[model samples]
Target chain A: MMEFLQQRLTDLELFGWDEYINYWFFLAMMALFAFELIVMAFKKAVTWNLIGDSITNFITLFAYRFIGGLIYILFYLTAFFWVYENFSITQLPLTWMSLLGCILLADVIYYWEHRFMHVCGLGWATHTVHHSSPHFNISVAYRFGPLDGFFPFFFHLPLIMLGFHPFMVFLAEALVQLYQTALHTQMVKKLPRPIEYIMNTPSHHRVHHATNSKYIDKNYAGIFIIWDRMFGTFAEEDEKVKFGVYPRINSVNPFTVFFHGFTKLGKQLWEAPSWSYRFQLLIRPPIWAWEQEQKRKREAAAAEAKASP
Target chain B: MNFFVSALSTILLGLVVGFALSLQKAEPPTEFEKYSSANMDFATMSEVGYAMAAFGRESTADYFELKDYQEYVQLAQNDHAKALSASDSPQVAASEAQASKAEAPTMQLAQVEHPAKPKAKPSLKDWPKSVIGIQRSTELINVEKVWQEFASNSALSDQLDSYTVSVFAIYSDFNSDYSRATISIGYDKPSMKGEQQLIPKGKIETLLKPSNYGNNALLNAWQDIDYSKAVKAVVERRDYTQNSELTSLFVIYQ
Candidate 1:
């Protein structure tokens, strides 16, 4: 069965079927999203803000794709090829087994990379754009930040060094991404217990996007929810889930949504008292940085009052 | 300011302690270390012998004579004696050296004549009309005969004058027997600038004939390779000059 599947994949690749799969799948999803809008309109849920937000999501997607393409062509591919050619311990043959292993490992790496984006201040500065949307829908999946494409290089480069071909790693990454894209919806409430436990369903991903205190920094899985369970980041959908980021940017304007994270970070850095504190703001968690900023403001106010007295 | 000074002082103190610790005497070599050192010496000697043979010079037997062997033994004994003397055991060192000499049998050195000059590099003019180079691991297979067979087709041979025809067969793994392979043929206009500047004539997805793998060791290893695999092989173009005749070709596998 494995050999048969491998041969089928090879045939599809030979016929260039895999190249056009993404475009076709995207068109199908867009159709589904349009149907969803019509359904929401019937239910009196469609608003101008929702429409603007979806448009902004697409704009961010285009920007991400443009920047991501430049980075991939100029840096990512070059680095991946160099590391694979020079440092790879062994070249794994193209087979069903190896491809499966690459996908599994790539998914695990995605979990950690996703977690990093939520925890690290710099990472949150970029990732916050995706989570900034108040509404969860298919269009929300398309929302991306400027450096979203760039950070994956750090996580996936090791796959190339581990002997999986760069192309194989790329395919694995795309599969993981595509799987997650389908989960950015509220239509599917839950699934069978086995699948819900094993896979990253819409319910699990909804919790991931939730900004509620209980759901903050939870469900960082890509294709498998097992990673979150194993890593102690897993949370079940028990309560009402709130979407969007904390201290929201409050704008559907594409430029505002795209640059807000970096602008906010820059403001914090400028407000920081010292170079050491500024550096700490970059590496520390977003919550810690926020707390530190509040502390700094209090200290500054107290010092000003004392000087005046 | 206080923090900076303390940090600097701590770093300086750490450096001094590290340097002092590094200057301390090393422990005696372990049995594994001695074995590894002896193995390395043997490997070095073997490499020298291989290098000489590869360059068409004398073999290892002709290179190391009885006199040279005796001289090496004498040098080793002298070094051992110096070490023993440093330990204030000169009498024991002398007795050991005497015993070593007694164990050595008297042998005559064989007179051998050395080559007067090094061999010259092969002229590019001697290069074949079509060159097929296969690189796999440390082995490089240059099959002029295979190239001749390929050039037998008038259509392919015609491109030799204006375009550099490159046939690249890429394998998924080093062990090609069980791996997948993909073959591509690229035609590039010969130019001096670089591969990037070359005007691509065309490219064709092709397959190598089974007969091509008959004699070549590298290709034979790839006999069972699956040609259905998807791979993109890089094409490398190189220029060869002999007198006024300039022959340009693409080195498919480097």
Candidate 2:
């Protein structure tokens, strides 16, 4: 059975696994959309507004797949190959053990990368596009910035430099991503106890997408739920999850979804009184800017009151 | 050929779905639409703190007291739920405003008192005396030439091109003072000639060790040196080029 699986994997690898997966991915997406329509008919589970969201999300995914790939080729490939060749500690061969090792390591790195995106403002600017949609469904899963993966290339570079083949590392990442895409749903309420306990489930991912106070930035696992559980970042799905970015996207414009955070950052930078505040606007968590703005408003109010008195 | 066919079909399928979606009429605005826009007025400090903490950034939580922490989180959660529910009618919106007014005390407190900033001590000076010695390395023998070499080096030439070389040290817990550690590279070089404490000068001893501090090795290293000490340490490179070294020395220091 192991040999058969490995053989299939090798054949798929030779045939370009990502492309092969892409063919199936579209089919699965259509099936999911159809399923959502059925569920909505009976239960009012989705809306026409969500369809518009899904359409915009589809545009992002299309751009990310084609244009993002071109950008990666022009910028990332050469440096990545150089780093792997020069700096890698050990070269692991293609075997079951190595593949498993690569997958596990890739997931660990992904957990951190996911957490970093939530923690830092620069990352949040890129990643907030995914969370902008107020509705949570399979369609929202594809709603990420076109160039989102560029920054994460550096994040995953360590895996390649640790002697895992870049292809293996990326393959593992693709598998992880495929698993995550499955996660962006409301249909599967919660899986079985063991599955929920071990792997990232729809329930856990809902909490990640939620802008509810309890859920804002929790459950940042890629494959395993254990990373969040072990790392003190875990929150159980006790409260009802409110999906979308906090201070939600008003427009369904794909360009607005893609560049809103950047636009906000640019505005903040222009208005900022100090260089430090401007830098903080660029690098601090998303909330930091909001808090600073509140502070400035309060200060201005106090000054106005004093002047009037 | 199969891949191209499949990819093209998928793209076309997406376009079809998108066109269908665009044709569908948008639903009326939900009652909660007012609260959907990102606004600081709606968010509490505790909410912000908890949000930051939820992202594994626990340091932001330092400002909140234990009492305020629970109260703020509870209030924030309640406010969020209320905002979500207020869209039912004008009556609910009125009640939501009242409820928001009730929650304003904490928000007022947050505005009245600015939280204390984290102290900034030069990383080198604050270095745990246990950092018995410091070593500095360069790609070129001449310290001045190192900057030009880094600038020219293809690997280190990018927009985000910065690297760190640890000035390694060996310190024993048993010997608190004068535990012998060598300053490995550039001890006699022009970089080390000035009256700078850049190199470990005398018996380097400190109260803290690598294990004493938090897991962030970078933050710990940053706190180890004073601004002047760091300047002194890099005095040689400053003369040759305006650009700073990509090297960062991350030592475990309390």
**Separate DockQ for every predicted complex:** 0.01, 0.01
Per-residue lDDT of model 2, residues B154-242, tens digit only: 33222221221122222212122222222222211222222222333443333233221222433345355443322212111110111
Q: So what's the TM-score on candidate 2?
A: 0.53
Candidate 1: misplaced stretches above 4 Å? A5-18, A300-309, B1-254
Q: How do the residues A16-79 of candidate 2 rate in per-residue lDDT, one tens digit apiece?
A: 4444465577689779967976897798756767777889988888877786778666756556
TM for every model, in the order presented, reads 0.55, 0.53
Q: Per-residue lDDT of A1-309 in model 1, one digit per residue for the tens?
A: 644333212211211222344556688889879878888999999999999999999999999999998998898967987897899756555444556667777887898789889888899899999999999999999999999998999988767766766766777788789889989888789999999999999999999999889999999999999978876789999898989998977899999999999999999898787999889888888999878768878999999999996
Q: Candidate 2: how many backbone clashes? A: 16
C-alpha root-mean-square deviation, candidate 1: 23.6
**Candidate 2 chain B, which ten residues in sequence have the lowest lDDT sum?**
B235-244
True contacts kept of each: 0.00, 0.00
lDDT by residue (B63-177, candidate 1, tens digit) is 3333343443564466466647676434443454455454433221211111111123223233222223332322123334334433344443344543212332222222343
Q: What lDDT would each prediction earn against the true structure?
A: 0.61, 0.56
